[model samples]
Target: MTTTPPPTAGAIDCDIHPSVPSIEALLPYMADHWRDTIVQRGVHDLETIAYPKNAPLTARPDWRPAKGLPAADVATVQAQALDPFATSIAICNCLYGVQLLMSEDIAAAFANAVNQWMAAEFLDRDPRLRASIVIPTQNTEMAVAEIERWADDKRFVSVLMLVMDENPLGRRLYWPIYAAAARHGLPICVHAGSAYKHPVTSVGWPSYYTEDYAAQSPAFHNMVSSFICEGVFAKYPDLTVVLAESGFTWLPAHLWRLTKFWRGLRAEIPWVDRTPTEIARDHFRLTLQPVDAPPTAADFERLMEHMGSDEMLLFSTDYPHHQFDGNAVLPEGLSPALARKIMVDNPKNTYPRLQ
Candidate 1:
């Protein structure tokens, strides 16, 4: 299989995963009580099924470690993701199972520990590293508090929330989290994963991991529509929402369908004053990886034309994940100007802290 070359020098990678080596790694960051609780209960690592250990999609073969987890340390990320891509800044969107805890208190505790672990183990060790503040979406008050807790740390470029949560992202219950993110000049990075509160697909649970993984695009459609139809952009005009690891190829078609329905159902959502496509262009940005493009470069350019904006795609290696082969993080057929936007300009604009 052929691959395109790495992105331009000094690219800003918008999505890279830094796995927690183990629950033991986070013990230092957690309170004594929580640590004791974990030990006493014999709690296992928070790794989720979203990225199974042997799954090719979870880690590129060369990037995987012989023991323990891939991207488990700062050095590995520097060598594999940052250095190879010539990343000026790379945002770590750790996808541990902090959101899976049923107890809001435990979820919040783990979330805090994860952020602290990120700072000490990753960001503090690498000047080029930035992170998303992972929050427990199970509790809005706690989620906002987590955002506030890390807002002053400019290394945190965004707030991370799973795409599949207790409820659709657009509901008023989730607005406080959005408000906190906007107020702190942090973008909301809605990444592809599930809290497992519901089935990954609308048609109940899928039979295979591939089915669950493929379902992420449609899930993103639900999220984008929820944000628009629920008037999230109207209320948070300055907010930016980065859809990390969500493929961009499906967007133009999805927005076309949404805008068509909105034209007829305008009265149902009065606050959505503009077309869904326009709203998405203004407030939504998507990471560029797992480029699910058509067969040819010409086809990709045409797809870009349909997307209607050059400013919406941020470059991402997706780190240890097997989104692409070798150092060919970018897809072919991109104009130099468009490549520049994806690698640098668009990410800097979308992530306030990056600027």
Candidate 2:
């Protein structure tokens, strides 16, 4: 593999994983009531299914921190991700296992712990670092409360949610969450992961990790469709939706298919006045990590051209999660002009809170 170059100065990393060092680390941040409840309830850790701690894909060997999970501690992140990448601003997408909890109360407790932990441990430590406000989607009121709590923190860039959430994300039930995000000028970041309420596929649960991995693109496909059809863009015109660690190559075709059917079905969803592709191009921004394009540079170039717009792609290394080997984080053969946009311009544009 040709070595990808280091990032230029002033580049903003749209996605970086800062692992929860431990459940114990969050206790300091948790409300005493919740902390006591958690300990009394026998809960210890909040781990995400999207990244199994032991999986090779979770972290490249060299990027792994010396003593903890990849990117778990601030020092490891500084050495392995921020310093090496020369990041001017890096947004943390902490995908802790708050979603997996059976009780909304417990999930909200952990979510609070996670966000508080982020502020003190990561954002406060590094001026260049910003974070998404992780919320417990099992409860919308609680999720919006999370947004309200962190809205004033410029370092808290967006509200984080899983793509494979319980409902099709566009439903009315989820609108309040988007409303809050828009009110605060923060985008809703949808990462590739599941709440595991339903099988990732329409058919059912798959047998292996490969099946789960491949299923995520389809979840993104559905997310876009649900957002557009349910009038999310129409409802919150200024709201932006950031897709982290989601493949950009699939979007052009998915939007094309949606647009094709939308013209015929416009009357059914009267609120969806515009074409689906138009809504996507305007409202959605996807991360550049796990570009998932074909190996050939020519094919990758073709895919970019097919995407037909530069605004939708944002630079992301998906820190410590081995999307690519070493410094080869940027996709190969991208023109320098496009590279600049992907790295610096697009991210700044997508996240209004990023200064």
Candidate 3:
């Protein structure tokens, strides 16, 4: 947040979205069967719970393309996000509808088509761009297969997921997907969202999108807890995990509570030898957009101190989704060194391919 620090030159934007133009654009990447299935059934694009196409928060007014959906093309993305921010490298995380289906096979097919489309349309066009390998969380087998398909591409730096999934992320059933990702040195990027398979709350669904958005903090807590207690980091010590668009202001208290409880509950999970905070601090990284810090810079600094690790944050504009006014994006109160870490060093460490 040091405003006078060096400009974001040679910096990495860890999360910027490029909206999928249309279902038709993905047809070329789809398998023949799915292509026929879609046409035959007259299936429309599945709207994602995370970002509705027309939602106010989905696209900043100025960033919207004149002729098409916001960020639906490479040129618009470059002009709006990359060029203006002086970003040297921008990682595109497309939040498409490939994961909303009940049928794992169809979901897998669409996920495949989406990744293929991303490679062909985005990554292939921009040398400065990298992308997350979107997977069908419904089927771990297909998910792992998708990972193997793009694992060798240094441009596909991480595996993306919604914060809430069909099951607890720490379950052993999901470990195969994690194993494959770790094998390829891909961090799991859990964005703030859900498939809406279940109600967002423990009791039931929420009344509105505002509730859903604010509830993300708790969801992230449970998600991180599941990963820690389930021994994901313990199992894959070298792996990194990124919480994209995840407002991390709540992390300090969550981790502190978990660690305090962990001491008494040590016997339940012997494999989790270290405290939850230590493990999470070592393996987890978060995006900096929508930082949700205190109003004053001093209070924000106090929260940063509470987080205990400088490496936990990686910079992101959350482009096309306005979290700040034009150009004055960096949060205030960070020391020159921490600002550099968030903008450059932390991301490079989180994503090995970035180096």
Candidate 4:
């Protein structure tokens, strides 16, 4: 049999999702009690869950069937990996974290199952495949346990969390997870999804998928702001956080407003020692994809200029998510060097395991 070559030396896809039937795929690897719960309750559809008592409003659901798995063979991924322009692919699984609202115990079990399965089935299968470890934020102890359990595995690159809940990212409850990531030298990546329990907007359910798509950035902004105001970056100086799925354009304006407010009301958040922009610029990285309509080179340039560091903005196709357009959304006239950095170098640097 002919062997498939590894991805080119310069390419790395920071965001990719390996589809799974449901949480059941990992049942055999789960503990007896957890496996029983999975078999009994079956998988909960995250979009249908209610918000935790004190959590934020639920995000609107413009439902679509889960993009479970692709029909393409391993050779297809190998082709993309080996494409001279592509280097490695880091796959982020969805349902894993979105299932958190189901029940704390089940959520954690689901997370453990998914991580172990991904580690065994995907990452173990391909040296080029890197994955995010999902945890159930609803139960911090279980979440921390799973983080500690897998932090040493090089195949696991980051801890994935959803942007929901009113609690600040810097809360003491989350510190253990941060410590685990710091111990492993892995970044924590936050993605938007059902936030099923926490909706930041008051639009009374968007009418269409496009509206929901548009709302993701604002919700992300709110979550990011909560993290900053709560001094998450300040509290966990060594930990890196990546805000994925939300585009980068709003960042500059939000930072400006936040810093201005902070300058006037420093007393409110005395723990925040550095300006919001500095904290964001230094500790946070963001993924770029689903670039807003009328894509223009100038817009991309402006966003890059505002972010102040090309390295902080990573490329993500949000592959198999339908909204993604491979390579085409990149603005015309973007230099190969910049393209290379956005597509691969930045992600590799942020998630060093990819290297």
Candidate 5:
């Protein structure tokens, strides 16, 4: 393990998770009817629906508590995530299972409650802490409404959605959400997780957690292709999308493959005038946590060369998630200039509200 931390002082940490303790914590934020329904029906906790909270991979041992959620409150997050890494500002991307509920109305209620709870519990408590507004992608109107509600609050920097939603995110059905995000200058942050509406893999259901986890990279590829081929960038030119915990080592190769196919299929998708790589370069930014890179520093440098741009990677620790050991938040072989770009410049450029 690396004993020396990265030169991360005053860095903008892009993807730290603030776990909701339980469904009970959000009850106060929900509407009276929804709260009553939840109580009457004896609703179970949704905390572990996305990923098993107690799993070793879910949190580092030192970050986890003996009993309760990993990042249940702001003070603990400050101590474990912010102070150690010397993070100047961090965006709280809560990964509760609000997106997993089948009922659209229930999902909307929970999403609203989550956003409300985020504002009151996290954003309001710490000036340095910002958050992504959790929206229910199941219903477009409700999703837009949620964005509008939090759009004025500068602390809520982005709109959060699960990568594995019911439909490919770039389908016109979800464009309204993107439109709202663009209008408000908020980036759409897609995090790795599943709603379980379909099998995690395209072929069939996976039996193990590892398979399901590995399947997320492919899901990201599909969504990025969806966004590019579906003319999302053409429609909303100023919009930006952040892929949190979406491992980026595969990006250069994926873009090459996608851009190559688009040349042959450009007639089918008339709106996608530019190559997929160009579109991705302009519209997408990815978090640096969970870096899937080659082991050697020289190999990693070659991978970065293939990427074509350093601005696409925003710095992140993926706080409380066992992504890296100790304070070795960054990968090796990064020059001080490149490290600064990833940690500060890229984040400021991606998230307009942060500036």
Candidate 6:
């Protein structure tokens, strides 16, 4: 047998989802009343749910678990993602608070189960693994409580939020969660996923997954714009937000348009002390994967130039999802230093636990 080489300078995957099949496994550890609701929703098998044809492809073609390691086992995860460049993997759960429209109680319970399981199983088993604590945005109090409970766990590096929540992320209703995140020095990761109760985009439902995929950047732009204009970033300076799975190309144009609008409307929101672009540059980071346009390296470089900061771009392989392409999709011609920052340093800075 030939010997395989050890991993090179470690890379940290800033975005990935290691899905769990059933909420039942977690139920035994969850609060009593919440178990019934989790079982009813069939929270298990969430990964199998098909995206509407309009949704953008996000999974890898052969992305599934090895035959028998526990779903949360680190060894199983290594089998799926252990690459020479990847030293650590940060996962975001699939069936978290996106179900809030179903029932606040059910959403809150599911959030609790996912967090508890992640902390006790995955995080506990692997020092290199990290997770985002899912919280029910529909109920800020419970969300804050969950954040506070998991805040100190080094492995729980951030709070995961669905992009299409009822209230724009900037609303006061969501401040409690931000406050909790800030208090604990954790960032918030907003990912685009099934918007069960909320519409996927303002442009109306798309006819195919490709259309839906194309619309994700806009959805993210809108939410990020809301947070900036509403003074979310101004109020909580230390708080950082990651826009995951949405390609980076649209950011420059979105920031330009938002800044222009903010300039004209600045007087209306006296608390927003900076331009939308400035706030975005300083406080937000975005993961790069499933790039929607300019599939070529030259085009990607131009996109990054427009994005303004290399630090703001993080490497991600939306692993196991059909659209992921391991390392093949990372833009070509990136300098080793710049590539290292996107693959490792940037994430280390954003998710402090990795440090």
Best candidate, lDDT-wise? 1
Candidate 1 residue pairs in backbone clash: none
TM-scores, all models, native as reference = 0.98, 0.96, 0.96, 0.83, 0.97, 0.88
Q: Which ten residues in a row have the lowest lDDT in candidate 3?
A: 1-10
Q: Which model, 3 or 4, shows the larger TM-score?
A: 3
Give per-residue CA lDDT, model 6, range 322-350, as digits (tens). Answer: 55454464667566788778887898888
Error of 6 at 238 (Å): 0.7
Name the runs in model 4 displaced over 4 angstroms: 1-9, 42-85
Of 1 and 3, which scores higher on TM-score? 1
Q: Name model 2 segments beyond 4 Å from true.
A: 1-5
Off by over 4 Å in 5: 1-6
* lDDT (tens digit, per residue) of candidate 1 on 1-355: 9555455578998999999999999999999999999999999999898999889899999999999999999989989988777788999999999998899999999999999999999999999999999999989999999999999999999999999998999999999999899899999999999999999998999999999899999999999999999999999999999999999999999999999999999999999998999999999999998789899989998999999999999999888889888777778889898999999999989988888
| 63: Cα error in model 5, Å | 0.6
Q: What is the C-alpha RMSD of each candidate to the true structure, in Å?
A: 2.6, 2.5, 2.5, 5.8, 2.2, 3.2
Error of 1 at 192 (Å): 0.2
- lDDT at position 195, candidate 2: 92
RMSD of 5: 2.2
Candidate 1 lDDT score relative to the true structure: 0.93
- Each model's lDDT comes to 0.93, 0.88, 0.87, 0.66, 0.91, 0.71
Question: For model 5, how does the per-residue alpha-carbon lDDT over 1-355 read when each residue is reduced to its tens digit?
Answer: 7566547989999999998888899999988999999999999988644567777779999999999988899999999989898899999999988788888899999998988888888888888899999998889999999999988999999999999999988999999999999999999999999888899889999887878888999999999999999999999999999999999999999999999999898999999998899899999999999998798989988999999998999999998888888888888878889999999999999999988
Q: Give candidate 6's TM-score.
A: 0.88
